[model samples]
Target: MATVVPPDLELFLTGWLRSNITDVDGLQVGHRTPDGYDGSYPLIVVRDDGGAQSADRVVFDRSVGVNVCGWTRNSPKDCRDLAARVYGLLTGEPDILVGFAEGSSVCAVVPDGCNGPYPVTEDAPYCRYYMTVEYSAAGIRQS
Candidate 1:
């Protein structure tokens, strides 16, 4: 029997991206992968969201869209790289918010039985996503 080598999807894609995007600057990543869930694609939102934060706000300038689909998977490196990019776009700020995202329109891709209308909340829980950056640094109201 021929030995089947497990392919490292993240590593492969990371290498390929690094080799191609030469002009880009610093990058970081944040991931929120769901366990035992299969049906919808993972949400990957990459962008520059770093700036002056307060006791209640966070501002962002630019956000990149990393919509993975058609059998595309994510990795830890992907999360870090995404955060780095967001930082670079905002002048390399370490205080970055790297996590999942979901707007008022889009619903998270979940299982069949556990699927339904998206909840009515501001901080939408995203499973296996990098980010949802803004173009300019803004503030958040943690009130």
Candidate 2:
């Protein structure tokens, strides 16, 4: 019997945004936002918010969280601007193709919903904005 395997949304989105968004040079993007990450300003973090697989296992509905962080001393506008760019890219397109390991790929990505480029008070040293997006993906089947 064959089984369907879902693509890693976090990794795909991280790489996708990093390669596609060329406006911001030196922007750091990753799957996780480390504790006290002091490497650079204007960073983007991608997180897997988890999702559901269809009963037939051929489709997956996934949610991803994207965060934009800027230096605290700087105006929050920078963080907001980056967040807006990400949001536009994700939602503006009708369908996005995300390729993963071995020949496996997400055939389509549909934006279900989006929330906030809001502030993060916890990370006091940096201004942060968070956004969430839902994706409908076609998984790969393997025996």
Error of 1 at 81 (Å): 16
| Residue 126 Cα positional deviation in candidate 1, in Å, after optimal superposition | 13
Q: Residue-wise lDDT of candidate 1 within 43-140, one digit each (tens)? A: 33222222323333333222323321112233334434443443343222344212211111111211222211121122333223222323332232
- Error in Å for residue 107 of model 2: 5.3
Q: Which parts of model 2 have CA positions greater than 4 angstroms off?
A: 93-112
Please give, for residues 35-130, the per-residue lDDT of candidate 2 as tens digits: 877635678999877788888778888777888887663667777888888877665443533434333355445544566656666746677888
- Of the candidates shown, which would achieve the greatest lDDT relative to the real structure? 2
lDDT of 1 at 133: 27
| TM-score, cand. 2 vs. native | 0.81
Model 1: what TM-score? 0.23
